[model samples]
Target chain A: MLVTVVGNYPKIPNLPRPARLRNAFARLDRGQITPEELAKVEDEVTIEVLKEQADAGVELLTDGQVRWFDEQTYIAGKLGGVEINGLIRFFDTNTYYREPIINGPVAWREPILIRDYAFARDNASRPVKPVLTGPYTLARLCRNDHYSSFEDVAFGLAEALNAEAKALAAEDPPLIQFNEPAITRHPEDARLAESIWRRLLSGLSGETAVSFYFGPPGDAVAAALNAGFTTVGVDTTIPGVLDAIAAGPKPPKLAAGIMDSRTTRLEDVDVLAGHVEAAAALAGSDNLYVNPNIGLEFLPREQAQAKLVRLVEGVNKARGGAK
Target chain B: MSKGLLTTSVGSFGKPPYLAKARSDHAAGRISAEDLDKLTRQATQEIIDLQVELGLDILVHGEMERGDMVAYFAEHFPGMSIGGLVRSYGNRYYHKPVIHNELRWDGPYTVDMWKYAQSLTDRPVKGMLTGPYTMVDWAFEEYYPSRRDAVLAMARVVREETLALQDAGARYIQIDEPAASVRFDDIDLAAEAMGIVTEGVTAKTITHICYGDFAPVYDQLIRIPVDQFDLEMANSGYDLLDVMREKGFDKEVGLGVLDVHTHKVETVEEVVAGIKRALEFMPPERIYVDPDCGLKTRTWEESADKIRVMVEAVRRVKAEYAIE
Candidate 1:
């Protein structure tokens, strides 16, 4: 079993406190500070995000997606024919995202994510798994003003993302995980979600992982695994999801979100390890991968790093040995 | 109902750019404590003037000093310390509060702020408190025996604040509870918890729930012991008002007639139509009008424009009905 983040590390460690990073971004936009300085700061701090994961003994790692503006907006804005409509609530959290609307046919403008992935791969001691927002989530989040139907828009997005995935794979990373946080919100979209993900991951060079969070995956878990992906991450903390995965046609690897990243409350190492053990037992396989239930971006970058340490500790405990 | 379709904000006007920086500077220790407080007071006064110029019937302090609703209160209250940042939704995040001991009202959390803002405006200012259930739901429960215990303890603490505002000569108090509708499984528990806080409060009590679907807990929410249900309507095209019309709300209804989540300003005519549609469903005498949620997420200009349009629309509706 391997441990890794679903996506996102805190962009800037609190320079002195919470929200300073946001203030700095506001300054950058207003031309008080140049973009180069911000990138330099992000690059310098990103090492800490990666080192925290590696130091915690997490097997697979992520670049922490420090440079992007927000989760989907940065990558989606990299594509052609996608425009930001307006800000919308991200999930049940206090966060908001600029809704990316499909204004025309979705197409990749260039290799948007390769450099971001390569940044992590170069800095990290551990193998970095790059995270992407799944095509279903991207399409579902976008306003389909130009598409013929939901299916048409979704397929367009899928192809665009598949191209991006192949480009990232060219960097020879271990796994390219696409996060579909929205799928669980609308159970009616499960079948379509599976198909869109299938379209996106088809013909990818490296390993692939698909996961859902902020809510239970419901029946979508099994449907997603049928797409010949290597891993499926289930947020066991979201209630009823553990049982849902227990009843699954298990994937080759399961990233069980056994600890929460949404809150700063620390988890007891033994208790969290028990959750991993339970998920493994229920799945009837030790293919269980342990990690935070959601992206660590919800935490302060330094605090998120601390959680990663605890996360790997739980994973090690479940393995019945120190890593 | 007695207020006769009054117009007001849902509290928390958008922070001006300077004010946001002042806060950031203050936190980084680049500015003195007194300087930050002075800036906050000045911002609050400006917000008051803006609401007055907009012709709002009721007023809010704009919560200029608040970083996040729960965190602001948690800092002042006992047994609660603000935790690290957690994503609430898209680009928005709040520092979650971690509660380890029994909650107690250390003193007046918002009374001084309420007194200052009210002193500046002739209009009745709503004393805003993050409702006990929300504080409990949004916090990490480090010491509570159960979720129920934590919520109930928070209720007692809130009741203390509400009564302090009442004693401070405030007539209206709003306990904003936007998180209530998120946890559907805890609706009954949330309702019961709310009852404990509003149990004996003398001020006119209101609760605001926004951003979540109201269908799941409407029946239980209707029975909550409060004077008004200030709901998010315009964002849903007032479909929530339609549901309330069908089920019939016996309590006063504060109709959120403008969307506050966006920066785009609504025209006066658009606001007029929203109020007109809401009036057709519920009795006009029992209606109060406001934005769909706090304006904190919007730009200051957008918040002012939306509120101005809303107040104008309320005036047009009242003139149509020939109410004094």
Candidate 2:
């Protein structure tokens, strides 16, 4: 059985200088500080966050997504014709920054500006998994102002992302996973989803995997398989997700998310092992990959790190590795 | 705004004869959306008639058209996709939707429907809206360069809808933002984002904040520009109100004295005591009797009984306060 700690890097502590600056920026939003000083604080925090993730045990570390407010909008800024909008109260909780629809011809403005951060992560002990939000999810989430359908904007975004993925793949990372949690929503609209994935994977140069979470697998799995992806990820917690594996032709390794990421209830290692065992039985141990069900963005720093430690340990034990 | 009577919601109070018929018709494909709307209208009218008979002040349309208050909005908005399939705390499974673009109202969203309901009765009709923050937070959000920007756009869309309701002569607008308590860690951001949505509304704005620990957000809650605060007090055992009293809350309080989740119909005396207990913290005039949240989850009988008791309780309290 193959076990891996898949998903975004765990949040890291702030560097003394940049920590002060990020705090200052937080204060600016609170009206405790002025907007004029925000730029200086952002730069400082970005540098410190990048450096901290590089030092952490994250195998596929990112810039901790510190520069952008959220995942989709950050990628939208890289592609042409995409404009981001203000924060909105999301859920009964806090605010989320969202991307407005693209209203013009979409194109890549420049190579994604992750070089400084990528260089930092590359120097770390573990190989990084260059992360990109899947084109389908992005298309489905943002307004398609300029394009006729979500697919049109998605295809354009996939091309832009593929260009960046190709450049990042040249950096010799072990894998690149495209995050597409939104694919699980449209089980009925599988053909449209498959086409988008086909185009997105076509843009990448090397061995790449596409991962999804928050829900069960969909027709996108078959699309990823058809696109010759090396791995296809799915959240195993949802109903019928395991059946999705049975439905598709087994071509790539399956990144089976067995750990619960949304709730604070800690999973017993034995229970986790049972889930992994079931996934391995279905996909075969050689094809199964272990991970949490979704991203840990909502979890507090301590809780997320603790959950990861438990997850990594449980997966290793399930794979019959001596912990 | 009177103190003599209590209020109850329609459709949710008791097991209406139409519920079984509607469910059967829906399963058999014999009932269309228009049919369902008609059934809801009739059910709402019956509830209004019951409230009038009970002599309650405020009347609700029983949230007839809505499935889930926040989730329903996702179905209408463009550039939004439901992400994951998960069961809510109430055992109701909802596909979590994600906002994918700049949100804009296509036409009059809820106004026409509410206006139609309002036209049916001479009683003051309360127009309910899910707060912009709750709509954004409950759904999967598209990533943005600026979180604040995305929130502002959502708020603008909400503001447009709210203003339209006011223009349609809605005297009372209830913006349900139950998710506000959960986002305590990001209270300031939430306040800023919601501030944009609530700008320039002349109607009696009453915000319903429920479900989570309100202690963390109480101070911030007071700062929100609204006329009244409808809170989940009965379900939470009134600890939140005590916290608010300690924080020196002086605004109008929508005291949710009835528990709409359970089938147990509270007595008029119990309802009176619940209100009287609340009066220890604030004056009776500053209080409005209501259920903690919507009674959509409860059966029609339970909803009616709960409201009946609430109204009786208000009468008892009013009589006692008058005697004093």
Candidate 3:
């Protein structure tokens, strides 16, 4: 079994590192530095994040999404016909996101994450997976002034994001994961989300996964698996999620989101190993990938690093050997 | 003076430059605790003086000692530990706290500040607290068996603090549940927690919620066991007024007429228009005018300018309507 993270990692360093990225941003706002200067700081921070993940034995890493203001706006702000607005709480967490106000037809203006993804891929010591916010979530999270209905926004975003996905596929990474936590919260949108996922995954050559957290994906589990996704991720901390996965037309791969990422109380290694063993039983060890229940952004940078170390230890324990 | 169109802030004024610097020095052990307290009182005095000068009806102590609302309480409370930095939004971060053991309230957290602020003015000062649901929602809870247990326990702690404030002669207590609207599914849980927090308190209670799409929880919000709902209306174009009008809000409303997030202060006319729109639906006697949220994020100059505009707006609306 391989250990991985869902998406974001903390951008802030542990301590005494001077918070170069945060300070650089403040300076950029003050007109003390240019956009190019800010991007250089972002690059340096991304390298630090990649180094941390590599040191923790994470086989797959992300750029820590250091460049993103928030998950929703980072992509939406770059796309055509969307404007970033004031902060709203991201899901139930304390963290907030700048909302995307859809003012006109949603269209792919350019490749949003390609540069950051390329930066991570170039600097990372391990495999870097490209992550995108799924169309359904982007649609659901946005203030839809243009679309007739929520589903319509989802459809519009689906077409728009498909173009970006195709552009990313040209980079030829092993897999691309679309985060659609909204489908879990509003299971009523599962039907629309299924169609959107199909549209998004239509012609991508690389492997694809859909990661859902904050709760059980409900009908979305079946919807994602049936959409021909190579992998389906579930946050096992959410009640009924493990049972739902057990009662499955299981996908080819399972990213078992077994560790709670939001809380700082480190899990007992034995307990974590037991969770990995249980998940392996559901979807054979070869098909299993261990992960935190969601992105590690909610935890402190130190805690996030510690959690990743624990996750690797658990995976190793379950596998009965050191990698 | 009229009971209608009461002017107030939604708690918190931006710290002065000297005080902000003092806080940093104190944190790094370059200054003494007494030194920090003196500067905090000085900053509080400045804010109270400004509010009085602006002819505002209610005042806040400006939260000079607090680095973050929830974390401040976490530091005071037992069985919790101040954890590490986590991003709250764009270019902003706060030390996210962790509940490592059972929650306990050792003593009054805000009574001294409330007392000090109230002593400086004849006008009422709000006894501010981070609400129970918000405390649980904002922190990483490691102790309690479930979220409900954690929130209910926190409510008891906050209830003690509210009672302490009342005992110390606070007329109004604002328990800010900014996270309540964020978790719309748990509005009932938040309401139940609020009930526990305010059960024995005699002071008028207010809960401030912001940055949420409140259409789904508007009904539950009205019933959240508080005397008033201090909402962020100006930032959301006052869409909440439509919901309140349709739902028929019976309680007092702290109508937010100025956007606090932006540096640009609203024109007096802009705020007057917002208050007038609320007046068409709800009576002025039941309305309290304020900024959309705390002005902690703004510069001291910006906060004062915005409050000045808000005060002038309320005064003009009152004069025109003969509200007194």
Candidate 4:
């Protein structure tokens, strides 16, 4: 249970393009590249990104999310009745596409494409964690365009996403991590969120470990435990988060988020190591994982590489101490 | 009516038990929109009284009815759809609105609220609006083919609202564009977009920029047509005052002498030193003291202490200069 660095990288572009052209491509409703062409571009980008992550000596590596624009949009594409819509402005010049508005009778669109992405990442290395956006977060953030209520939409999304998770599990990856940053937004939706998580995990087959990231663990922790998942991820850098996770069921693996990804300031290895140590103390050293809280998409390439290097070195040092 | 010290609007407020109950009742179908509006009015009155108790020069309606600064505008405006999830600092999440159609403001976005607060007090009330650049920067622009077009459309809607506020007897209007610094790479484009959005608003206008480096955008900010510029300085330790002095910015400068994002109340001496340092760059008359941004992120107690320290610091600076 020694703390291991989980795989997830932010979007890093190799060359600079005109910002206008980039924005145009991002928001283009029709014309230009087809979905297959976009997938081809993403596959090429993922290959190069996998090499970068592998070179950095990260044990688990993501395809740098080249396949999807953001974490949720990728998951939304597979869910039935979710139509990807226009681009919205996100914090200061950043923008992401709206996840498809879930219309009536949400169901899987026949054999969700988890195997396609898992096979893509598998080309890079072994034990790749196929990432999925959690059902609760997708439902909470998305407009209930045609759904009668949030709970109804959430349950449908859960069923759709769980089908994808089971499909990915068939590929036999080491784990499947769901990015559920939206869970922290609606504390009132905790019960429904927990139910969604429980249903998804209960339906998943095989030894696929499920993890969450970006916000507080919320009632999803209990849901994950009740569903008998192995690891629960928590952003430890946020105040009062670790305490909340500690209050949950015992002996669950903790993906302790120790690195800051939003700002330009690089984490001092010793300081980050101290956070890992603290997390280990709280949740047994055997049950801890060192990770950056969220994606590194906001960071420059040089900074992202530097942060990853420092993280790997810090984790190795902390693990040695644990041994 | 006595003139008061300058103040700017910040989002978020402690929803008291009564307000919470009112909101719950409204949600549970026990109250109508009119009833909720009345409750919100009562809360605004109470907030204005608190501002008077603190002896501040300016006042705001505390944005009691709004869930967030930008979301309030989106709910009222047409052609805006919310998309994507944004994490606000810790675990707080905001669903950013996407502009899907041609943008237009129907009329008088916040005039009723602004007028209501102003009517209650002789003291000047600052009208608050989120700037065009910030609205464009903070939301997901799914409908617009380009970011520049999206921003221009957003500015048009904001300009309409700004003019309406001026017509409604707003003396000072604060357009918060905290995202300005984040778009520093495209300052000229931001300036152009902001220029269009702020057109024809003759009232005294102030633009606030915070949460990032200021040196790069300092010159660009000065070029904007606003009367005053509000910036976050205390957090940056007045690191860019030299740049301001070198540029010789003549307009009124709102020096953020208090940190608003944290709970730690800055000492009076710290606030005074920050102001004194800024005074060396600009005249005391041209300088206004305020917190870095809105005190909404902070607890009410911390916000109060920070404001108290800020006023005391201003008084100390004024006494030293022997001005009032």
Best TM-score among the predictions, by candidate number = 3
- Model 1 bad stretches (over 4 Å): A15-27, A238-243, A279-286, A321-323, B1-3, B14-46, B85-95, B120-122, B215-217, B261-264, B297-305
CA lDDT, candidate 2, residue B158: 78
Q: Candidate 4 lDDT, tens digit per residue, A143-164?
A: 7778778888888888887877
User: How high is the TM-score of chain A in each model?
Assistant: 0.92, 0.82, 0.97, 0.84
Query: What digit string (tens of lDDT, one per residue) describes model 4 on residues B243-280?
Result: 88787788888888776656778998998888878767
| Per-residue lDDT of candidate 2, residues B1-324 (tens digit) | 334233533222342667557856875898886787778777767767766776667666665655567666777766555554432321123455667777777746788777886887788888778877777777656544455666667777778888888999999887777776775655566677667767777888888876666776678877777788887677667777778778898788788887665567777776677787778878766788888777766665666677777776777777777722
Off by over 4 Å in 3: A16-18, A27-38, A145-152, A321-323, B1-3, B264-273
Each model's lDDT comes to: 0.81, 0.67, 0.88, 0.69
Q: List runs of model 2 lying over 4 Å from the truth.
A: A1-290, A293-323, B1-30, B81-84, B89-92
Which structure among the candidates has the greatest lDDT? 3
User: Model 1, DockQ value?
Assistant: 0.35
Error of 3 at A164 (Å): 2.1
lDDT of 1 by residue, B119-197 (tens): 9988999998889888987787778877888998898899888889999998999998887877677778778878987
Candidate 3 per-residue C-alpha lDDT over B189-299 given as tens digits, one digit per residue, 9 for 90 to 100: 999999999986789999998878899888887789999999988988888899888878899999998888887789988898899889998888899999999998898
Q: In model 4, which regions exceed 4 Å deviation?
A: A1-323, B1-13, B24-30, B84-86
Interface RMSD of every candidate?
3.3, 13.4, 1.5, 11.9
Give the winner by DockQ: 1 or 2. 1
